[model samples]
Target: MTGLGDSRHVVVVGASLAGTRTAQNLRALGHTGPITLIGAEAELPYDRPPLSKDLLVSDWSDETVEGFRLATSAELDDLNLDLRLGVAATALDPDTRQVTLADGASVDYDVLVIATGAAARPSPWRPASGLLQLRTLSDARAIAARLALREPVVVVGGGFIGTEIAAAAIKLGCPVTVVDPVAEPMTRIVGPEVAGSLVDLHRANGAATRFGVGVVDIRGEAGALTVVLDDGSELTASTAIVGIGSVPGTAWLEGSGLTLDNGVVTDARLRAIGVDDIYAIGDVARWPHPGLGAHRAEHWTNSSDQARFVAAAIAQDAVLEYSSTDYVWSDQYDWKVHTVGWRDPQGSSVLVGDLAADGRVAVVHADADGNACGAVTINWVRALNQARRLLMAGDTAEAIAEQLEQLTVRAA
Candidate 1:
């Protein structure tokens, strides 16, 4: 198979985890062609997961945070990539194979990879000072500085990031409250059983909850913000962190003739629908999964997995249908929550151990047909690994549950 060869120039947008990994993989695969990496932020690519995790809770210096850099200056130089930083892609012209930058300059490419990733969904309530959202390193630094003050904090969402931020704030001895409209905010991701345990864990760690409520308005200045609830109640806090969700960064491809429904719609091979020589990955691409059907994965593992797959595909290597085990994890207090595959709350769930007593439990979920769909385990790394292997091996949910039950009983 003849790869693009050393002649074709590949342009990758978004110098993020997905983008950086893709560029590095391309070089590793012996693609000696000209590779250009573009990023909107001025800083080099860094890990985003730590932005809400260790960066917010610990008093780590900027150098320590730089340890999370995906690629150092030396490594990037070794890759021989034309690194373009602090410039945003304003528009994409598929017909001309050109990408216009924010500086009114355009770059032509033989092949284009859209790994633009996603942006933090802005909160409707914007206070001049205390309101914050964590997406970039800058945002995390601001939140960490505010958390150091140990003032009262109100988190306006109860999703994974919101809950994680709340946990970090609680560690700082700040009175924290998590507000969400849904009863169990993350039930759709980790299923009802595990999400319920998470809520309890937060409460046990001195974090307050305002579940089943929505934010009506945010009033006051930065130092003191009043959060008004839909139920006509109010809570005052020194700072507010919004972790609602994120939207794809595909606005530049608006008139590029590519299908954009929530994200750039791609086929099973990660190729953009209706466009040749263009591929999409990471949070910006909604591709078809064999089990889950069509969906966009926002997890860190998904981004890296897609990057490796796309890199291999571009190098004319053995291309396999993109199939991910779909793993995601969260850290709340001392508990480590891990999940694999898909978890459906409406489906049958088999619980192996007691979440309250053992502090370790695994919930195996099955579809209506009784086939294994996913599993969620709390502080049970062995059980989680076992479930992942069995799920990938086509084991039935009932069969996996029986094995998990035996393991839990033996551990007891």
Candidate 2:
């Protein structure tokens, strides 16, 4: 495999984890290209998971959210790659191989990597002032300031981000209430049984869980928010944090001719189907998985891994078939919950280990053939490691259970 065409002009969008990793890999793979890193955010690329966890509770300053730079100023200076920050790509012309920026600048690319991650989905009903969505560093900083006041916080949506924010608010000694339309929290992701555990945990922590309730409207400024539920009940709070979900940042690709279902459709190689010389990765990419079949994973592990795979492919190497180890973790209430592989809802769900009061729990999702479709462990590091190993070895759930029993005995 030789360098496809002149690999001199490489353009990457988004500057998020996936974009940064892809840039790093492009250089590391011996591609002598003038890489251009473009980002819409004013600040340098930063980590996001901590924004909902430690940043909310800790006294971390706003400037601390600069994030881990894949290539520092010195490194970037040495590499001499063009760095364009706070500018959005407005359009893409595949025929001309050019990207038009919002500033009316055109960047021609020999090869383009689309890593324009997703933005937090805005609430349908706008607040009197404005609803809050924690996606960027600025968003996180503002939320942290509100939580520091130790005032009543109302969080809409029970997804991982919302739950983590709610738990962080509780830890910050603020009155917290979570309102979700679902009959149970996290029912859409982990089903009723797992959701039940979360329900109990939230209650035990003294956080109000208003299940089956939907927020019809939010009124008032950032200092005071009035939340009207679907049942016509109203609750006033000092702050309202909305984390319904996220949508792909692909509005710029409206007429790109590349498929965009929930996100940019890609094959297993993370290459956009029907589009040549372009690749998409991260939260905005929906690619087929070998183990989970055709599915788009919005996990951090998936983003970074996909970036590496795409980078190798870009370098024209004899690329290995893309497959995921399927790792994702969330932090809340002193518990570290990790999941490897997609949870097969139709498969059998089993609680293999007791979490006890300390928030240690392990559960496995098995297919009809007893293969491990997914595994989730709360505050159980050993269980997470074993699950990851089984996923890599392609072991079935029944075999994993047998191995888990031995682990329990050893712990005993």
Candidate 3:
């Protein structure tokens, strides 16, 4: 791997976690090149995980929010990034290697890294004032204020964000109801076996569930909202938080000539397809995975991992193939759920421990070929670690479960 030289100017669009990390990694990897990090928001990059968990349930304060900052002022200065804040990239001209900003300014670069990430999908059923979606810091602040009211809350979509928001609402003593269009909304990600336990956990915590139903309409104003379900039932709540999912923030790249599926299509090396010296990372990159095929990972760890890999690739350091272990965790009530690799709901899953008795369970999933593809564990960190190691080694699902069981027994 050869370096891009000290004089090469690299422009990073999107001053997100991925964007900030990329700049830091480039400097750390001995790249003396000029680097510019641009973001649409005026504030510095902050950690988003707490937005769904701690930020929502806790008392609202600017100081409390500042605690989630990814880097302090001194750390940002050490990174030495040419920070462009409060402006967004309006367009991209890959041919000219220039990015057009909203302020009628264009930044030319020898290398470009797109880390625009993703935005929360807006709910089709929009009410006057109570409808909300959590993506940015402002959104979290608004939701936190609403939760502090201790009013009835309806959260649409039972995905990770939706569930976590429900958990937060529960903590605030709010009457919360989570609605999803599937019998088990997170089954595709955590498998039906483990997902069932999650559903039960939420139910036990006093969060009502309305699965297999969709939101047809939202009526009324801020303090009084009626959420009409597909089954002709109406749920009355003071506020509604829609956490359906996220879509790639690739609208600005409409005519950028780069291939865009769900995101900017990239090779295994994180380089944009058919584009020279252009890369995409984080939620905005749909990269090829060796085992999972083409996939876009929206997890926080994925963004950081991709940023580190792309930085090394750009700096011409050790060129290693990018392969993600695909890790994600969720904190719901007292349970800490963790998953590794990919879980297919339709795939065969073998349970290793009792989920009902101890809330410590591991579900090892296997593909059609009987190869361990993924695993989900609840309050069982050791089992999850063991499954990850075995899965990476291409162990069979049976073998992984057997080993996990033995480890559990030995510990007992």
Candidate 4:
């Protein structure tokens, strides 16, 4: 209502990494306003990246959620935020500046932040049992338990999340099969050159591939489920993970007068278009990029960066437009894959190191005009760091490749 330490009530929907981090950054930026942190899950805000990796591969307990929590009960108390866990924001009235919770109550807010993130796109084929999609801690726990049985696992996508889950299941000694309709699913993101290596990596690690076909229907239940492929083939598995994709968590905002296409469309500053006193971040927000046009990035780094930017604007009236590093990473078996920026198919790419001959490698990508735009590194941290710097600095693709090659030589 007043200034940073005033009595303004800031209600943040979606207690996710983005929501929690926004709250944290607001406090760190000296916003003493009453912040209401709402979440649909009862669990404390924990990191979701591990839901498909560490959480499934390793043995963990219900309490393991706390180990990955972004903040604890004590920390929330220290920040003096009103904790509204296990209840979702069912309705939002931007005109009235009020949030209607599922608990039949309403809270007035001077400012509202939407960071609900996303939910795994629901599987069209739902059997009586044995179908799972990893998007939350509970989902991860259930999936971990299923994989622990060391039975067959059919991951219904070859994208990063699905592949990561498949890797986890394979590591647990489960016979795994990755099913995808898009033959080379990663071609759009990582290009065909790298996608081939990824396919090899999966085969090298003992994960089966059923690409170029999709599951038309699934029958039976866990431990006896039958995956019916569109090509009239069938694969029996103990469990099936449908990681085809995800949808932005915007169902609750349907009648809230907010524009939602793929997500909450925002301006350059991430403020919800056509509304004042409201902002959207994380997977739920699709903001414009100076170079890449408008799109939503589900990467963890984007969430962190957007949260801090929005908090600074609210706390200090900051004017700098938000710019993302566009960074992402994944762990499949023993490989550590890191990607910086987007890969342009129309542009050219330069391979710096040999992944087969060498243990690590880097692929530098350039735009049509030869400006370095992106890089992908496998098990090579130094190359990743250098790639990030060079790409961010707008180095030529050739320049990036040369420098990475020099670094490779030095390491050798």
Candidate 5:
């Protein structure tokens, strides 16, 4: 074992949010170890959520683009990092603790953090042309170019990404239609108490929706395409953007001997199962969560939180097990959607405020014993803040709803 000290070298795969934050946190925690950050994309690490929320709609300037960067060139140099961008880790040899890069080069490390993250699921309905997916800055730029054409667009998913893009297209004066296989695609996500309201939000904002049908096939080229649905219906569009989901970037680790399930399975301490000195974090790492059992979170907060946790454990020799409530936020059209903790379908849900009447809503979920477990708030930051505070303190659904109602009245 190469001991855990400032003298050891730490290699991080994937220079996105999780990986970059891991290195930053290590440095902040006073670990002067030699750190090598490997990234597949040539671009410096940047924020991703804005790609769907703002980049597609705004007339961004050079300074605005620079703002997206996690750190500037000078800032990175100050960290004294061996930043290896435009190259990806090809293979890993755990026995030797060496990572081989794509350019026929290998780097050794005493500590390794598998923050490689997940990639967008490839579109299955391949047309002659004009298909898009958002996973990288380059991908966002390509989609922005297509969206600039001001032609009709079909977003083939009803999730957060798809809806955000749809909202952006609508703002761009493009005819937009969102298609999803599930009747209420958000039911499984935001829950039944408020899913329909969110779907109606898009309709109210001038975007057509074709729910309860799956895309069977797509044909034609860019600016003129046909989308065939499973329900024997067809829709024509100039472009189609698939925001289905993402898969862990574990293909390169095929024979690496890591217990790969949906992601790199990690124990309670966020350490890769059955391995010493190697840890996994972010979307690519499935850690044993205290609240939800073995779980993998794809939210931005989850990745950032896990990075800090893992870095503390490594740099400061922290012994606490990793724990966090699931949190996700999205900017869809004119409303801000914020969800904290998990949404339990089996648990009781209390709804406060009406979306149609007031354009704001909050849903608090309570466990079997009437303890607040999770919450979703839309266009109501105060209520969201209170819910998060009360949830952490284990408040009851009734009490949460009453306080939210009081807040609603005061705001009114």
Candidate 6:
């Protein structure tokens, strides 16, 4: 394996949050090596969470939503970091440590960080222009234009992205309907108990929630879109947004000989499992999670934490293991949802607080032997943090409930 750190060429692909942070941390670690940031998007790296929230509310200006621009043209000039935008990587030759761009140009690097991230998976059932996918700033901008028409909008997929966009459309005074195959939104992530609360949240906000249904087909004509559901129901609107899911952007690494499953397979250290001097992070990484004890591809906290860990490892020239705290956060309507660790409701679960009646609540998931597996919190950041610490301490369901009760008593 080639040594990293001093005078090495570190190339990071995908200029999203993870890629940008990797570059920033590399500099912070005092690595004087040449750094190159490559991105397929035309615009600079920006925050994606806000695209569904603030951008839809019309509160965020165009420039403000462009997210955190780590380095500007002048900043790049001063730092002498090569910032390549609007160029798609065509292939990767791990043996040669060379990245081939679409323009037939190749860049060699001593150390490579594959932060290619993930792309919005296009709907297989929809026509070329029948559905709109949300991922990039351009996608958001296009959807915004459609929402401005104030016509009825149907959002496919009831996950966080779909629900958030639906709420935003509701705020815009547009009649919005959400369709999903699952019985409740966010069931896969937060489980039915927590996801059911979200159903009520959307309903309370005057957005129609159609669960246990899927958009079988989409047909568009004359500047209008029609979405057909599995149950013979049809929804027509001027615009339709599809939030199905995303696939890892590792197409260029097809013949790289590095492990690739849902994402580029990497060890806990974020290094490609079988290749030296090659690493993967962000949404494009599939690593065995510390809490889950299984390989998973997560989009948010995983990326951030892995970037920091990999940066330090590259700088120190040592193999460092990355263990996730398994933290993921989401904002829906007036509720702030935070999840920590991995939770299975089939396991022992204690209703830490009153959830049936609502207000705010917390649910702690425990394993068969009573060890805390994870927790789901609604609008309860303080309690969530408490749960996180308690889980890390190997607390049980009863213990966590006691802690929650103590928190409630203190709040009173």
The TM-score between candidate 6 and the true structure equals 0.94
Candidate 4, overall lDDT? Answer: 0.89
User: Per-residue lDDT of 1-412 in model 1, one digit per residue for the tens?
Assistant: 3475656788999999999999999998888888999999999999999888887776687688878899999999999999999999989999999999998989999888999999999889877779999899999989988998999999998988999899899888899999999988888888887788788888889988999999999878777899999999999999999988999999999988999998999988898997768999999999998667788899999999999888888876546778886999988778888989986545798888888888899999998777899999999999999999999888998899889888877876
lDDT of each: 0.89, 0.80, 0.89, 0.89, 0.89, 0.81
Question: How much is 58 displaced in model 1, in angstroms?
Answer: 2.4
Model 3 spans with C-alpha error above 4 angstroms: none
TM-scores of all predicted structures: 0.97, 0.94, 0.97, 0.97, 0.97, 0.94
Which residue pairs collide, candidate 1?
Answer: 130-222
lDDT of predicted model 3? 0.89
Tens digit per residue, CA lDDT, model 4, 165-221:
988898888999999998887677777767888888899999999989989998899
Candidate 5 per-residue C-alpha lDDT over 1-412 given as tens digits, one digit per residue, 9 for 90 to 100: 2224567888999999999999999898888789999999999999899999877777777787788888898888988999999999999999999999999999999999999999999998888899889999888888888888999999999999999999999998999999999988888778888888888889999999999999999899898899999989999999999999999989889999999999999998888899978999999998877556688899999999999998888788888888786889999888899998887677889999988898889999886666688899989888999999998877788988898999988987
Worst 10 residues of 5 by lDDT: 1-10
Model 6: clashing residue pairs?
none
Q: Tens digits of per-residue lDDT for model 2 on 89-196?
A: 999988888999998999999778999989999788677763678998789878877888888989998889999999998998899999998878676566555678
Candidate 6, superposed: residue stretches over 4 Å from native? 1-5, 59-62, 66-79, 128-130, 356-358
For model 2, which pairs clash? Answer: 46-67, 355-360
lDDT of 6 at 294: 46
In angstroms, the error of model 6 at 56 is: 2.5
